[model samples]
Target: MNQPHTAQDDGVRQRQQQIAANLRALILSGDLRPGDRVPSTSDLVAEYGVTDKTVQRALAILKAERFVEGQKGRGVFVTTQVPTVVRASHYPVTSSEEPYAWIADNASRGRAGSIVLLHVGEVPAPAQVAAAFDLEIGTPVTVRHQLLSLDGEPVELVWSYYPSNVARGTRLAEARKIRGGTPAVLSELGYPPHHAIDQVSARLATVEEFIALRLPQDMPVLRQLRVVFTDDDRPIEVTVMVKAGQHFEVRYALPKPE
Candidate 1:
């Protein structure tokens, strides 16, 4: 039987969430380094003015989300694997000299990154994808599904779409990997990307994402819908990117106000 919702339950849940948020902020801000021991449960309870049970629940949340681990007879410690910071404004100068821009970027950060082309074929455009392409809902489009990894661990899943008219008879529709990635192919086709806009959000992982990203739980994922536009303001490509939220954060470089 389902239990009735109550105000006390809501209060407890909010307090637990507050505790977890505080610890998460500290870890992400580098105030608590990897392998650093988190304060004891009794200490946290004292600090947060919550019961020991509430503190334990908050710690469990962190453990399930890969932020911390508990050791025998010892308190919780930050996991050795820390969150990766992605520079939102970085883009590769695509050329034969540097084909895989993403791999190169990760290399610069001292991490080995690679991509696996899981699928390439025609599919009915999803609602958002169709809208980006200025087509009616359920329009057909060429889609490429890829899984991106860092240090052999899955980090992101990407699905890129192109209108059939734009991608037909081109390498974009091919099942094999593109030598210079998609930007080079688009450029050669006279639709060089002039700019891109990204819409980002966070939500609990879907079943597919949980399995693909190997998430420890139904944790949140960072989702991005990016639309690339070329000369004449034509939408050339639409991409959906999903990353494990606990392990990734986007950083933007903002200009100073005049």
Candidate 2:
């Protein structure tokens, strides 16, 4: 039989989570930048008014997630693998003279970005995707799944779907990385992306996501479902993007009033 939960156990876990959350925020905000030494255990214990075990447990959480590392005698320091901030609204605007937006975005940040096309085939649309494309449930759609990497580290898993008629004989249906990404190809086919809507959420990683991302644990993942529209407000594409929640953040810029 499973042991019953206790108040003492709950209290310890809460303290551990609190300490971890504070340190994680500091690392993500650049307050404790890469290579910066985390406060010594004694210092953290004093700051948080927690026991040594609590502090150690918190540090262990961060270490496992790759946020910090321990030196032989130097205590823990923030890792070089800082979380990536994604400029959500800007990365989709492609230029003919430059690489695809994702590549250019990473390149601008001095990181090597690459994409690997994992699979391509006709599949029945998922319910949400079907709604986005105005197709009935179980309607056929061409799906292309790819792995996106930054500095050779797997970052995001993306699945893009298009109406079968729109992708049947196009590069989007092929099992190869597109020269300019699908946005440019869609433009060539007269379905230029006019705009898009994105919905983002955070949840526990699915088994597939956990393995694909090589996560250290069953950590939360950010999922963004985007629907792209072309002329006449017709939906041309639906995409699902998944990223490790602890390693990525999204930014959106709002325009000021005139």
TM-scores for all predictions? 0.85, 0.87
Candidate 1, residues 131-196, lDDT tens digits: the string is: 888899889999999999999989899999999998999999999989788999999999999898
Q: How far in Å is the alpha carbon of 55 misplaced in model 2?
A: 3.2
Looking at candidate 2, the ten consecutive residues that score lowest on lDDT are 2-11
What's the lDDT for candidate 1? 0.87
Candidate 2 deviates by what RMSD? Answer: 5.1
- Please name the candidate that would achieve the greatest lDDT relative to the true structure: 1
Candidate 1 positional error at 244, Å: 0.9
User: Candidate 1: where are CA atoms >4 Å away?
Assistant: 1-18, 45-61, 70-74
lDDT on C-alpha atoms for all candidate structures: 0.87, 0.86
